[model samples]
Target: MSRLLSSLRDGKGFDIVLVAVPLAFLLVFSGLPLIYNVVMSFQAVDMFSLGTFNRPWVGFKNYVDVFSLPATWPIMRNTVIFVVCSIAGQFVIGFALALFFARGFPGSSYIRGLFLASWVMPGLVVGAMWNWILAGDFGVLNYALRSLGIISENIFWASNPAWSLWAVIVANIWLGISFNMILLSVGLAAIPRDLYEAAALDGANGLQKFWTITLPMMRSTIGAVISLGLIFTLQQFDLFASITSGGPANSSNVAQYWAWEMSFRQYDFAKGATISVVMIAVVMIASVIYVRSTRHEVRG
Candidate 1:
């Protein structure tokens, strides 16, 4: 049995070699960081003790403090709002854009290119551009609105806590459509033209065709898009942080930003690690449900 096992390992040597570089990287970085964070979460270490060779062990205290935070519920709520609004809005806008492009009208290729450009742009760059566009004193958005007599004065833009959250949401919506449009375009392309022809012959209008044929036929694609979007949004940090830095008054604080603040800004590594662990658990639980529901095969 030992010899057989050794032979089996030898048989997989090439596969192991193929993944050796990535496996080594994951070990040195991802695995080590994850293990270290988990360990940190169980210990009690202050900023002064950060470099000390000796660290105190205080099981679950970090976690307890994490859950005990006054901002925890609000931050979690903001995270939910950010995830749901960003993903759902992006999905709808992307689907609509995909449908419009599918018509193959004039300049459709250019429009697709525009969507691709947004997708390719870095999130931080997008956020920085938005900060200018939404700037209070000299924002193009408020300028145009004022010129059109939509309002007498420029709004606070991102100054107010409530409005700042929406500002971030708006920025999210703008960038999010790219993912949906790109994915849905392929799904739209994969759909057979004959189905549309048959539906047209049956006196079905475009809306009817889309509802009865396009949507159902593209369920798997839609599921895949939603799943990826959910995963990305759940851990989203860059745009949110760059846009508001967790906000004018902490109103826009999401779980990601909170974790960053705890770990980096507050210099509380143990509590930060605890928050990271909790965030991982939440994401994993949600992803499990999402993956199970979106499974391709469901027949009993």
Candidate 2:
């Protein structure tokens, strides 16, 4: 017993213990809940049977019901669009900003730090702020566009079915840009300056150097950023709740918010669980891609 205690107190056993604590915590908190959700997806669950573990096993009936719903495909399509567009917008804009700051202009670091403010702010708070910005009557966006003669009339960004989805996407992109920029900036910073110097000696211009050197070096980081972005986008619920609430005839509804609406608002727990299971599968695929990307990372 004394030997065991000593090993735990002063040896590699201590490191194992440190890892075990968090692992145990995850098993109890995260793993169990995830297992329960998966199990629930396969079971017929009502509010009455929710408290008990023993429920009717419905197999894939819930999944079938989920797919049979008329709104399912549209919501799934919207989710895909939201995820793809938000990621593209965030990554493209973020890469641009990262490169811009990588130039090391005076006060660039401070300005880049300020951009993190958007990312750290609560999503609901960001959504609320954007509410007025995208508002129809006196929103700054419309006002600016009208001032520049971009639109003939005030656009109801959040209310109109055609624009409502895009409205959320726009806000989501803005919210995600900071995170993407910060990660990409780190990736940019990790790249050896010597490579650029070598490329310059070889008469390589900015574009050629970026394509040949910067991109290849940052492959791992890009994969990580994109995978994390996909997960974050899938888990995004606060913005939907605050900004759109899946409004305008559910034009802006995505899988996550729709899952919540099904489980809580309408009490269709099984279908909600089904939707979440599908989302989990999508995230798992992204995780696999991230792992594959990391395998290609160049060693120093």
TM-score of each: 0.87, 0.94
lDDT of 2 at 243: 82
lDDT of 1 by residue, 219-294 (tens): 8778778877877777778777777888786788888778889878998888888888887877677677567645
Per-residue alpha-carbon lDDT of candidate 2 for residues 78-125, written as tens digits (9 for 90 to 100): 999999999999999999999999999899989999999999999999
Instruction: Give the distance in Å from residue 260's predicted Cα in candidate 1 to where it truly belongs.
Output: 0.8
Colliding residue pairs in candidate 2: none
- Score candidate 2 by lDDT: 0.92
Best model per lDDT: 2
